[model samples]
Target: MEVKGRVSNSTGTIVQSEDEIDLRRGPWTVDEDLALINYIANHGEGRWNSLARSAGLKRTGKSCRLRWLNYLRPDVRRGNITLEEQLLILELHGRWGNRWSKIAQYLPGRTDNEIKNYWRTRVQKHAKQLKCDVNSKQFKDAMRYLWMPRLVERIQAAAATATAGSPTASASATTTITNNNNTTYNYNNNLNNSFEVHSGNMMLSPAIMNNNFGGSQSYTPENSSTGASSDSFGTQVSPVSELTQDYYNNVTVVNSNNNNNPNPDYYPQVQDQLSFLDCITSPSGLFSQQLDFQSMEPNTPWIQSNGDTYNGFWNVENMLLFQQLTDNM
Candidate 1:
């Protein structure tokens, strides 16, 4: 009966905890945000646990830290990521893999959480929709050859529009794509290797995206206008499933002494000098060394190539050939 009586006065018997005040959770309130910001402004950042306590924020240290680093920081940049920023994110992500914090270091004012969100929501969404592994070889190829070019085109388009509106911008805006590395860039392609297809408008072939895409390798004037002379066009079955796909899109190779190819058997065949650097630019060593591409079913139509188009899954041999053709291009 005594124990029962003791328990009956729940409020009286139980000593109030030091943190008896209400602890807020979930989305932050304007007042709470102001409190956090003002407290940080006066005291500066760090010592999150003590900061939260002294700041009068009814939140955990981690919560306060996250809000400050991700949002409240004076330098933090929000809103949609620009094309240049997007390219950097992809490149940095490729180099660092899931190291969001490390990747964020390269992007000024961009938060790790923002980068992670962009990768998961925008980048991985494509892979998920395609039903392919985000870390597969096929998917990587799609990103390099398909998606990347699309990003480049968008950047160029935006630049052009901006220049047009100002009228003071030069044609150099379109021709000069800043190198990702601090060094200079000069693209091998004359910016007209083939059809100027936008990523949003272009249709991707399922067969070409499959791991066994080889049949589509035999691209010609009827298929790709990549400026490859008709005589230079030849069919070669390339096992891209094992082939090395260099992520250094248009990374310049410096062979000095004013010399020609010392070894004709070198891996990448030497090509004619470029009038300008490859439009694509990325900070060197920013992305993972090289990642395998993931690929799956095509949900859209393929561009007309010699009147041969795929409406569904491809045959094994044809799929392989398609991959080879894409590789050749």
Candidate 2:
């Protein structure tokens, strides 16, 4: 195929190739994909136009490059993005605005096009559902508070299902919950590094359950063997305490000296009467807290519904946002 052209001077004139071979366009075929792959594999990539000609691919340099990078590349990950990937995209987009290329750097194996499509389709659709601009603060808050928690729960549930075949846990199937009284916490307003994760049960550092109740109470599973009794933290914890250990699912605790939790003055005014579901489930309203991402524990795992441990971060608002999701999923 030849493309005839005309010539013109540089002073507001058009110059074209006398005869240029026409390049192919539109959808790539299997042969083209295999050709691109074999060419890159044998000769490596560079000078893409020359590569395309050498490989006998009827495509332009730009077309060849786009096809290779966005579609035929061996490393390009396809299918639904994981919850972790979605969270990272959301966090990065918030930080860098619409710089999709830069955002693509953080998410390995994902192309900028994929992230943009997801945002425009799912995220923008949600914003439209709420009748708000995609760039509005309300939409961002919805992403932060609602969608993130949902994703984390889904991730946790999936991970748990995957690991369900592992060895039977000592704590699983026992309606009688155990509390490691040896376990201690900092139920105070300063929740940085509240408590370290131990062998079983996600432990609360400063006592999330103690905010409204009188005095600090730590539930130790070891001593939880006997019938309920008033013990260490000055509150009554049951052996099969409705508030069991898994209350701290997908919770990301920071080790910051929270001079800025935003809710330092806010106090929880609840009764001692609580259940396992109560501790993990989100309150009726959105609970806001100032979170400093610097203090987070990297790659910390959470316990899923089946007593299996899985890795994911708490969305950093309130802990119970995804509580109901475990059972529902």
Candidate 3:
């Protein structure tokens, strides 16, 4: 249909085109979807306005773009979001608030719209139920301290279970990290023995238990038979522990010997318990630690539940802990 001049139709609202063709909306039909897919496959994507017309699709350019990017694309991943992904979404949202496209870059296969919807439906709902603003420090602290740790615990549990039948395979889940000082540390994932992901250099070890937030205590898995010895940092590394140590050693090195002559005393006790506590409490410092973006699964959808049963997250124990934490906050 071609635009002739301004005219009013059933609604008596004057529109730009006199003989305007009614554009299709709502869910796309199978034929329309196939046409779009075939057109793109033959000619490639971009120039959405002309592509829509050329492809004989009555949908608007923006609509077609959204549909392709969010749904019909070959690489669009679909399924239930895994625990690892949930942790990542929370972490990324904290960093780049409302910048969905930027956050989507880190989480491969996930569309920005999906992430935004998940935040609104799941995260914001929980915040509303708690009777606090989603951006409030109290709620953020609850997520950082309580919810996020719970997610990490779930991810570890899932990973452990996934590799359970293959102890040999799990043990092979190791990463070699090189600090800025040119010191290389080989990390292993010997989850059976201990939760301590020791750096080969014995630099810093962080605990990965439910309540051990930044505590230096060593943890051994149930019925494990091994123990740490000299040069014992050869176990498999959990994502968080590995990322934390790598970030500290490579990104934020504090050397007392540097003659740059400033407040070198800033983090005097970098390797002490207090520093670990600081890492835990400081939201900017804690979640900003880079994750293994490659390990993230395809676009998966996850939702958090209300009180009494939040995907096994909000038990009496966690509720009490959250209260105690918020009170402190």
Question: lDDT per residue, candidate 3, 223-275, as tens digits?
Answer: 11111111122243323333334443444323234332112221122232222
**Stretches of candidate 3 above 4 Å error?**
1-19, 166-309
lDDT of candidate 1 over 178-291, digit per residue (tens): 323333322222211211211111122111221122222322222322111111111221121001111112321223222222111211222421111122212232222242
Per-residue lDDT tens digits for candidate 2, residues 1-329, read 33333556778587655233455667777667767766776777779988988998867778889876665543344545545466557756776778886666554445788889877876676567556687877666656555554544444333343334233233212232234764443222212112111111111211232222222333232222011111122133322211111222113222234432322112122233223223234352122233222232223334334322112233332234333323243
**Sort by TM-score, best first: what order?**
3, 1, 2
Model 2: lDDT of residue 124: 74
Please count the clashing residue pairs in each candidate, in the order shown. 36, 13, 7
- CA-lDDT, candidates in order: 0.44, 0.45, 0.50
Model number with the top TM-score = 3
State the lDDT at 315 in candidate 2: 31
Residue 327 deviation, candidate 1, in Å?
Answer: 9.2
Candidate 1 deviant stretches above 4 angstroms:
1-21, 167-329
Give the total clashing residue pairs for model 1.
Answer: 36
Report clash pairs, candidate 3.
Answer: 81-301, 188-235, 188-236, 188-237, 189-235, 189-236, 190-236
What TM-scores do the predictions have?
Answer: 0.49, 0.48, 0.56
